[model samples]
Target chain A: MEIAQIATIASKEFWDRIRNRWVLAVALVFTAFALVIAYFGAAQQGAVGFRSIDLTIASLVSLVIYLIPLIALVLGFDAIVGERERGSLDLLLSMPITRLELLLGKYFGLAAALAFSTIAGFGLVAIVLSAKLDLNALYHYFGFMLSSVLLGCAFLSLAVMLSVFAADRTRASGLAIATWFFFVLVFDLLLLGALVVTGGQWGGEIFPYLLLANPADVFRILNIFSLDDVRTLYGLATVFPRALADPWLLGLVMLAWIVVPLGIASWRFRK
Target chain B: MASSLPPNDAGAPLIVAQGVRKHYGNIRAVDGVDLDIRSGELFGLIGHNGAGKSTLFKMMLGLTPTTAGDIRIDGALVTGRDFRAVRRTVGYLPENVVLYDNLTGLETLWFFARLKGVSPAEAGPTLERVGLAHAAKRRVREYSKGMRQRLGFAQALLGKPRILFLDEPTTGLDPEAIRSFYATLRQLRSEGVTTVITSHILAEIQERVDRIAIMAAGKVQARGTVQDLREQVDLPLWFSVRVSKEDFEAVRAALSHLQVEAIEAHDDHVKVRCRREAKMAVIEALARLDGRVRDLTVREPSLEDVFFGFSD
Candidate 1:
């Protein structure tokens, strides 16, 4: 509840990452990936040069969905457990700060670092594409960057939650990887199997709602749905209902993803 | 601000614990422990490993919740919520704290100062106090173990706490550093800072603390001043008597009634051990041996012996 304590812890956590070059490394990864996807996005189609912002965003959407979550998970999976292993938790806890403040401060600080790197990384692509692409494409790319930060925060929350529940670093990281696999790879496959076995009868009505359950899918639908051709190309326009594709609603869902896991993390951390 | 006294000896003790217990599942880490630490007293807690020393220290700082009982610091109860305020007025130096090696010594102290809600500007002077002022700009990773310990001590000295808790503080310190460490602790005590330090190195803290508590198997086996403990344990005293070569037999024979064991019968000295109560009698016996004894010395049992005696 004490903002000063939270800010102190948060600032320390943020600077620690900055000193370790994690922020710069992640930013470089984003910039390199975005630049390549922007300049040579259609290399498979034998096309080169800055492409349409929509095309760049569509490609970047898939990239962010996989990359941001992984980055966030790795960045945060050891937030609490790492402190404990390093034998600093006792000193930290002995301070005049509450566990909630520590947990929130760590989350927000790392979230800021992740958000900063994401913006710096993708903002470069935005600037380069700004001259070539139109205002609408520019908006979509900015939206892509925002959603990417949200997804990172969500995954970071999950990572911190794992750090709290896990007994050690090894188990925390294992649970983090398992979480990534479930959301990115296994969740959709299982949903598709449920659809096939049900002959599109039992769970078909609830399929779109279920897609909203995963922050990655919510991020995907939010970005691609802004464009007609890309939405059709991605084929999510048919699966995710138009009403549920409201950017505002999906943003709320992503916000929930960020808060709910972090809330649980704080709860478990205090326990 | 808490430096002033209450005008009389009616002020509350610095720390009060009543039947404080910590149970991890079926394991009783601290069981029914009652303690009182007075203001400006430098107390020592010595126990074997896993003797619940660290656990009790943690409970005092409100780092861990007690399974039962209560602990009060400066008359304020320490709990999950209330301990936050009390923590600001206290300092702690844990055993083997691995700080952020990436930050300089000054920066590390500032970070901890900020946590304790004190001014980071105090970091420089605090480092100087711990003899790390010249190395302020050096990163902690480049410092030696002794330097790191000084940094930890510097952090604990922040805010000029009324009470300081140190757990096994001299683990890696050299003799000179240990001496200086106690000197600093004595200086703090002069300022009315009650320090509670735990160490397995009994010799290091024997003469430094005001009182000592010997813990064994989650309980305080004995608690008193070193002299008081020596009086409590019925340990035998050592006596070395110097006698001439011609009178060694007479001196030994005279002291044989006291059941003194002849450790060595040198021409100049005869060593024996006896209980403290028999000291005067044995000296009298030696005196009656025709002035054969040239010199006599009596050595009382040390704190180490008393510690082991009570621990066993």
Candidate 2:
């Protein structure tokens, strides 16, 4: 539990990613997508120019749900297994640091990298949208950005867990992709199919809880439920109650999403 | 476990293993083994591949859990959280450690120094110690295999650890570099740093280590000084005599009077094998030829012979 050792590992991971152009590449992608969506999100509705921050956030929420999780998974899928394969794991584990410290250091380092790109990418668009929107709109957009970082951390945690549990790099990468596919695409469909088959009979009471199971869905509900127009568009008022949609509770869930998988990884790595 | 440790004039045993074993499913990597490495001793572990040298080394470092017995370092059992504190005072250079190639050699050393809680200022001197100071600023990717091994050695020398474990440290080193490597190891030993090194190349470490352990099939076949093992095996000595073309037959006839195990005759020289006790007698018989014998050489059994004798 030495902070110095953890900081050393974290700083190294941070520099390693920067040197590999991962941070720059991801930031550029986010900026490009956010700019295009912020400027042209209303074109589908026969409108153009910088739309309201609400519509911009709605567009970016879906974008972040798909993009951030994928980026995060790709970023961390090889964190542990790759090091083991590279023959560096023995050197690192032989150091004076604990396994927990190594796991946390790597997670924080990668989380910082993902958060940096998320902020840098979305912050640029926020500045552009600042002149067109008021303070309230800016606050909502920042919340969206914060949630995007959380979603990234959550997925990064899962990726690190997979890296620890998988036997090799190829298996780790495969598990990372499968995790992304399951959470981002298959989760919602499975939830909806379950609802339709049961006709809200068997698992109706646990439906909202099940939606919270997927961090991506949690990110979706957090951003989409905040705005009135977006809320009506997503239409989760019936199954998802108002109490469960509280921003604080949803944020806690996202934080748990980040911590639990990382905690499990630390446990498994120590074993 | 306490009683199993041997008395050490160098202070106390720095590393102790009591019947340590490791099992990977049905396969046994390290069978029951007992060992003691004293402080300031340069110990060598020689074994063929799959002989469990690496497994035993890992068990000592607590990198892998021992299946049945226990290992102690500095009198404290290396298990659970206690070993974490012990690790700070230990250094290890595993075989084929691929460092972060993107980092400059100095950056790599600094990172490990920080992890070990040493000052980054120590990186320069450590690199210089391993003769990598000139290339400290170069990226590791640009370095050769030998250079990377030196970097790994430099990292292990950080903080001047009390005990060092080097698994196949000289695998990729050139002859000159290997000489310098042993020189550094001797310097460390002079400073009272106990070193445990494993190498399959018995010749490389025969004279370098204070004591040697030969392992086979996941067990230590023999462990002691090279002289002690040689004496135990008591293999016959070899003698080669060079004589004039006319005197070669006379020398062979003189040697046939003694109990020669085997003999070979060339155009101008004769090679003979005799038991250990017969060495002096054989030399005396050759001395009777005196001026007729142009040259004489005695070949005692080497550590390699002892290693093979026990390993078989």
Candidate 3:
């Protein structure tokens, strides 16, 4: 693999987002939402002000779980298929670069864009609340920002995978939306319904392990398990074993979510 | 001018395809075919929409895998490990070439130059070479169709590649741009760049390309110089003779002694159609009429006629 070739394509994709203000727009959205949730999250409970960092991160996690995946999917759903449909794929393939290199370049470029926006958007919030929070609170907020970036990368990987396998942009987009619905909305609910219908008799032992199957859940667990207050508030501390909640282990699972889909996309694109 | 001599006079074959084939399940996009393109030669591939010219072009560039056989460029298999090195020395301009609409003309060239491992600084001069330097900073979305085509050509000229593959290169160019495009091609030829071009406009490339390949029904029906193809097909030639209306019969009688195909008289001239072998004899017969033949113009078969002769 030529690093130069990959870097060239990656830089082009990254700068395209930068020049078009896609990165700026996404960062602004994240900042606006994070600030609102940080200051007004407890309003329904008859309290509104600068809340505890733990409670703020918990609310932000729920928002990111829905927002990042959708942004990532939209950002990357057209990576390969768009080139193919626009008739640029032939010219790009005709270059000296390999298909694997091109695929990796595209993935890394868009991943960088999504990661940048996630960091900038939420990092601004961390600064705003830094004076009120202690060192421990700052560390948890930093962890939340990191996990949010990973979730975006994972979903971007899936979107690129769909771009390669899909016949056109329309189909790739449809597959992307379907992927978001399944992972962000339906995966955990189906696991819960399976357990309840079986009266806890079926798949109970593997329930916590199955949560790792969804990157969104992994992101949620990664952020929630690190904070003591948020961990109990979600009631996941009882069913999700303490041993399996290691932040390092959950982080590795998130990395796998990012890598595996890209691996499949590279394979399909080579064919 | 290269057609005047034998094709081998140019150099050894730089690109060779041996029984190359590509099948899309039931459809044979490129049937078994053999071809050789010599170094520094301008070659043309012409055919109808579904004649598989594009498929064969793609296979030659390794953009599409061949179902069977092998294609080698400068002795390196297009599908093999050394293809990256081979590709580095090759340039391609795809048909209806599409570039990033969001990029400036200069940025577009730099993007391709980086991919080809060339210096981004070359983008300016390359854009100037294609007459696109004036619009270097303008986004491609604002360029006209002809300007986009020029930018695409500029991208292909990066890295000073030794070989070029152009597909329907003049699709949207004006007469002046078309003239300059071929002029640049001629300059590249002098630098020993072997170019293989495909065109739907037969007349546009007939006089420009050194040799031509006519494809039909997924096969190369004929391949050679224009003159060579005309001779192979053995189409008839036309001779228009200008004479007084009263001497029309006399002009016909002069050529009647020879094996002339047909002779018809118009208001100002008479048209004579005859076989290729009978050309010199017919000319001699017409020359014998001397004073009666006020003027004589010999018209050989056109490239279109030769194309239809073989493709049909």
Candidate 4:
């Protein structure tokens, strides 16, 4: 594919978000929420000062699991379907660019916006807490930021895929919300309910593998498994085997979450 | 104005479609149609809504795939691997062209110009060419419908494309803007740019286009110059002969022996209708009246009349 054509479309999407302050607004939201959870995470136990980095990250993970996917889906659900509904798809398709280039460009551009906001918003918290922690704590914080970006990218890819398959913006949006509800809220509950109803005898061996099916759970494991204090505190270390907790493996799974949906979007858009 | 061009057969065919067909289930949007559009020619494609003119236009631009046949631009397949090169030389203005409302008029042109690999610097002059220079810095959301149409025309004029495909381009423009729009088209024609336009306003393009294609029921019913189509349909011609109230019967009596179809008298003029071949004979009969016929004018079938005759 021609990179120049891709860049042209990507830059438009990127600048549209930048100029409208969408990135800034999201970044501010991230920074505010992270700082609050960092300082006030142990308030229920009568603590108010900046807590341990492990506890801060654990609290932040809960917030991000629900927030990032929703932001990504809202950002990208209308990328293609909106153009079709507004009657501009014909003009854009008439250009010299290929359908693959347009799809990739749109994905990369919005991904950049989401990544930038996630990094800036949470990275600011990392700086404020750096004086209280050691290098290992800073490493974990940076890892948290990176994984958050990947999670957003994965959800954004799904949003774009829905945009291509949907006939109009209204339907695309409905599909996006339904996707959010499935991955972020219902997937894990259904798995847990199955395990409980079966009394742990039916899905004990496959339960950890099934957790990888949801990117939100994957993000949770990726962050929570790396910290020893929080790993025992969250108690998920019992069910999830140490062999599957490799940071690189979980990162690859997250990358798959981003790539597979984008690939499907590209294929469907070309048709 | 279209008469200023060279003969119809002068230029080679720049766009060729061969038995192209697009079928959606049982509906034949474009069915086995073949057409050739010559370079430096202003061609018009006129048809009723849902007659498949837009579908055919999309196929020619490679925006929609043809299910059965092929469309080639400049000897290259429109949907081939090398279509990027073909697309660079073409510009299109879709019907009811929609642009981003958040961008300024100049920014809209720049966005398209960059996509076409043209320099963003060209956006200024392109907007000026379409009479949108005054609103270059204003957001498109603030523009009126006529202004938006002009901006869409400006976007199509970017990159100096060799061919232009305009679909109902003058939809919301006033009469003055429509004149200016066609004037710009005439200027482009002199530079050897082939234009294929579709318009519901047949009268607006009858005198401007070099050749016309009338489509109906997913097929081209007639294709030729306006005069050629008029003759092809064999529609009647009319003559308005000015005569005094007293000489009305005398004027009618002059053509009584001829094969005139109908004769009706108003206050001071007699309207005579006849076949295309009887034009000269009827005129000669009126000439025999000498000063009795003070004035005489012949009216051929209009483009709308011809459109209805073919499309209906």
Candidate 5:
């Protein structure tokens, strides 16, 4: 709602996190991750070399969807609490800016940082795919990056919310990490179990609704956006057709996760 | 800086509160109270532990909503909505002034400056003025407590606020830092800034503040100038006279000449305080007597007396 304040905070957050060792170190770590994906995607020059597209796309998809959100949580879980503990919040309040400004600033900062990391890390994926192969997967690769970014934003918003509401930064960080684990590592298992209990009947209709709650669903849909050219193959060959069925609707739903949680956090910050 | 605020009958003061309260569950911190702070006056809030000075400050700052009554600034009522706007004009420094650990002093300064819409070039001079220009390039993590305090001051002073709030600004500071901090406050006062400082150390704000409010049981028990607070108590003044060992007996014998109210004889001096207005007359009367006066000090009742009297 407050534009100028949000821009200022966003710029500061972006620049400040850029200098954070944890954030910067993760970027380097992601750079290495990009290389690993490229190697696995293309190293099979002779043995089962189903072309470099398969392995690289799979690796980039997995890293972008799963790993990036975790990185976001790691970075943002202390956005507010860290300032409060350090007593900077008190000083910040004394300034001419409002708490809403502070909230929007912090969110924008984290988002900007994520954008940088996403661009650089996934740009590397695009680079490798473009150079090492026919450079055909560039378009799909960005789709993965864009979807991953939107999903990551939702996770970052949740992290910031936890940071503000929890009693302390340590507890906030712990809760943020736990939430990430539930979505990334455990939710899929829970979904599969639910589908199994219904004897595969649940997988068709009701399971998709269940998937919406998990932040991973957004990433899945975005990844489907990257594979638009091969929708027919996905239906015939891959297990990812669930997201491919109607990607646009899924994209909007994923975006809602980002906007809604952050909206609540801005409200809570004022409170 | 010695200017009086809005005259004595200048309508409602800039900040007024009636029966303001804050209750954090069982701990009903700030009970019902009334406060009136005139514009441009340095008002000090003094209290013992659990007296709720900080709680009141938080309520006023809109960090926490008040349980009851009203808090206003510049005639604008502080509903939850106006917190951001009100905060812009109110600068605050907490007891423990910590800053962004990873940011350089300059970096942190610029960050706040940017928030206030100040350019880095404009902020540079302020960093220097706070005596941290040389240290600006250094990370705040490497800064000393005093340095951080100054940095916090710089941040708080960014907008040249109308109302400034500080909670125990002298906690970790050394004597020199304390003095400079006061000097800075004095400068702000000269700039017509209204400051409300909460501190347990009465002596710290004893001379600088225009008025002080002493809080107990979550409400202001007494509020006035140091001289006025002294009047509220059963304060009788005291005079201390120091002389050579041989002159002790003579001064004791001459105590009757001054018609003194009470006398407590120390090893080297005699202390006297009377209801009579003529403290100088006693000294003059002592010179005419057999007493040999080496030194004399007339004692005014300390802030401790005022605070402790209310404590009881």
Candidate 6:
């Protein structure tokens, strides 16, 4: 009911985690990666040693696509139920804020923290790549990185939703990890199993919708979203389905990842 | 603190719990209990373990769902969809008061104060009020039990809440802290804050609260002023009358005249628990018998006695 109240709650939650030790630890790790990426780029500057730009691109893809969601998971899995276990749920509930506000506050707070970390990480990467990489390429890299961070936020929102539904923090953490595991490692395997069972009858048609459901696919699409040539990466000499590889569809998928789980969490939190 | 008008003058009761019930499977935590907490008063709810005190308090805070019945605060329903509005005016302090162990006391206070919409300057005075200003810079992990209680109390008092639900607020507090805590509570009462305090320590709350409610077996068996509950105890003014060796027979014979045969004879003394009407008769009969009464100690009915008496 109170937007200011929700924002206040979010500000507290955000700053608490922002000042946490883990954020500095993440920064240290990001700094180390920047250093390594810098050296790798400088060594391959003149002659084609290994394509530092491509390595930078790969780093952007894996670091944002895979690592950030895991980071988000570690941050978000215990958001709600942990407060309940600590007996501070009573404290939060005493305020004039509604359950929707509380959940949204927590969800937004975590997303904001993850987004801030990503921005910092991107800034540090840019500082390292300034000597070799051009400004235009750096802009695209930042955009893809931002999308990955947003996807990570989507996962965090889903985790927060799971945390609310769970009876306790431990169960909530387990469910969050299981969801991340499904999206990251198990979804494709399960889909392949389904395709094998159906004998490729609906794989092409159903795969797009299913991939849209998977945030990792969206992250991967965002990584190559700003590329000048997307069709070349298909590796298929004769057949490249343009629909599955559409950048606009990737944006739609990224938007879905951000909005759908958050909507569900808000609804579940309504008193 | 809610108002400066008058004590118990508000037509709108601070808390009106009518047939407020909650059940977990077959165990009814709060079973059909009606409670009215007046304005500007410290209301004590004393009950033993599993007596549903916590359940009732939780229902008032909207922490746990009520199975049936409704609680009204200034005529707003404390159940169903409108509970959020009810929660606005209420502050709660749980028994365990577990805060973020990683943050400094000042940071924690500022965070909760910010969440409660009180300014940072407002937080400083609150911490000082609870006597936790010195330990504000220390992390919660380093805080002693009493200090954490202080912080918890300060948080609950923020924004000048009209209603406060304190669940065992002084469970492990030291004697000095308890004394100081009660002083703060009295100050809050003067400020017209309506408080519902739950505790197992009955004696500490007797003079602290304006009214008392004794709960047993998920039901409130007695609810009224200290004297009101004492009357429900239905026990007499008991006394242990001691006499000299030479006057033992005279005292025993004197008690017999007042129909005090149910005495626990201990050497030269007799302990008698009888109706209040028989007290004066026994005393006068002792005087007539010329018994040398060395000492007499009278036992009065407190909330504990009232609860256990009616609990039977």
Chain A TM-score per model, please list them: 0.98, 0.98, 0.99, 0.98, 0.85, 0.85
Candidates 1 and 5 compared by DockQ, better number: 1
- RMSD of every candidate to native, in Å, equals 2.2, 3.1, 3.6, 3.4, 4.2, 3.3
lDDT of 4 at A137: 90
Error of 6 at A26 (Å): 1.6
Off by over 4 Å in 5: A21-24, A41-50, A132-136, A201-204, A224-244, B1-12, B80-85, B118-121, B238-266, B270-289, B292-295
* Candidate 2 residue spans exceeding 4 A from truth: B1-11, B243-252, B266-268
Docking verdict class for candidate 1: high
Ten-residue stretch with the least lDDT total in model 2 chain B: B1-10
What's the residue-level lDDT of B94 in candidate 5? Answer: 76
lDDT scores in order: 0.87, 0.89, 0.91, 0.92, 0.75, 0.75
Candidate 4 chain B weakest ten by summed lDDT: B1-10
Recovered fraction of real interface contacts per model:
0.95, 0.95, 0.92, 0.92, 0.74, 0.71
lDDT of 1 by residue, B44-86 (tens): 9989888899999999998888889999987778774567668
After superposition, candidate 4 runs with Cα above 4 Å error: B1-10, B241-254, B264-270, B287-296
DockQ of 5: 0.51
Model 6 clash pairs are none
lDDT of 4 at B280: 90
Indicate the docking level reached by candidate 3.
Answer: high
| Estimated TM-score for each candidate | 0.95, 0.95, 0.95, 0.95, 0.86, 0.90
* Predicted candidate 3 versus true structure: per-residue lDDT over B111-151, tens digit per residue: 99999888899899999999989999999999999999999
- DockQ (0 to 1) for model 6: 0.56
DockQ, Cα level, model 4: 0.87
Candidate 3 TM-score, C-alpha based = 0.95
Candidate 4 residue A61 Cα shift, in angstroms, is: 0.5
Clashing residue pairs for model 1 = none
Per-model i-RMS: 1.0, 1.0, 0.6, 0.5, 2.5, 2.2
| Tens digit of per-residue lDDT, candidate 4, span A105-200 | 999999999999999999888888879989999999999999999999999999999999999899999999999999999998999899999999
lDDT by residue for model 1 (A93-196), tens = 98888899999999999999999999999998777667787777777778888989999999999999999999999999999999999999899999999999
